[model samples]
Target: MPQTSQGSQAGEGADPAPAGRPPEHPPRWSWWLVGIVIPLVGIAVTVLTVPSQSPNRPPAPPASSSPATTRPPASPPPLPVGLFRLTNADSLMCLSPPPGNSTPAAGLVQGDCDARPEQFWRLRREETGTGVVYSVRNQHTGLCLSVDAAHKENDVTVTQYLCGDENGLFPDQFWSFRYDTLRHAWRLVSRNSGKCVALPAGSGDGEQALQEDCDGGTWTLWRT
Candidate 1:
């Protein structure tokens, strides 16, 4: 039997999709490509946004650097205790009691440099408000060098006496050393008079040592 013309046209016009269902989706590979491309774009953006340190940049210094330490200078040694001969610079003589006189209150004088007990003096130290002073003690008579209180003149005679005061009330027995750089020696300065032990001009043997103005000259300088 030959089909009708209307039936043939209806059969040829059948629906490509089902009546109540959605159309077929795209290929799975296309979805995978979209997912990969989106993540790659996000990673590129993150890398560009963050900052990076330069390869040649120097490292930062410490927050608080410690300062360098320095050391103080050393102090000089103290003078030693011993018996010594005091020689006058001007007259070039040794200081001792008057020749043939070893008694107390005998004046000190310049004499020939010899190995006499009268010429040897034991230097004893005494700390005072002024400074470190010395008591010039005669080894022979066991007396201390002192200034004559009776003489108030510029040039006062220096004598030897007992080595004690009631309470250091008298400073005549205390003497300090003043350094003379030019002469390279020490000047014997009296603590009581603030004067210097010196020899007179054109001093000769047997000349007495007196307290005079501190001229800082060869006359006032003495060597130990």
Candidate 2:
């Protein structure tokens, strides 16, 4: 009791720490949690601030182009050959050579429309100019309408002659038929004289056919 020093009395007043250990400090994980939690909160704030797109919007349409072009049709060609009856609009009389005189130099006259061989003609298109010229031959005589020796004179009687001369030297033999749109009839024009085939006024059976200025009258109008 006399020797129990002051050092022993001081140790008993304060508790002693455990062996091989340091004094406790605040945990370092709190700072690490603060760093991780700050980034997570920032990401959540960014996600909530942005706007969302609508799902019901329609898509855009494509561009357009121009239209195409077009054209028209052509006209029909004429017939090459055919059998026909030559008649006038006035009397409807058939053209024929005087009975029993179907030879060359015989004159064409108006007769009954009786389907006789003399009344039937074989019309063949001449391969010459414009394909409008034709050789009008008698079925019975095998001759064609001719202008005496290819004469170009007026009032010259039209007669029958042999066919097969395509030289055009005798344009008298070639005849051109033109459709008169106004008159609604056919006009027989001579290739040589350029005059029209006409049935003279006061003409009857056995009368010779002649040429005259085109008048588009029934006398100059013919039917095939």
Residues 93-137 of candidate 2: C-alpha lDDT, one tens digit per residue = 888887768788777888878967888888877787556688888
What is the per-residue lDDT of model 1 for residues 105-199, given as tens digits with 9 covering 90 to 100?
78899988998888988888787767788888888888888888735356788888878767752568888887765566678888777888888
Q: Which stretches of candidate 2 lie over 4 Å from their true place?
A: 1-80, 164-169
Name the 10 consecutive residues with the lowest summed lDDT in model 1.
71-80
Clashing pairs in 1: none
Best by lDDT: 1
- Total backbone clashes of model 1? 0
Score candidate 1 by lDDT.
Answer: 0.81
Q: In model 2, what lDDT does residue 210 have? A: 80
Superposition error at 6 for model 2 (Å) = 99
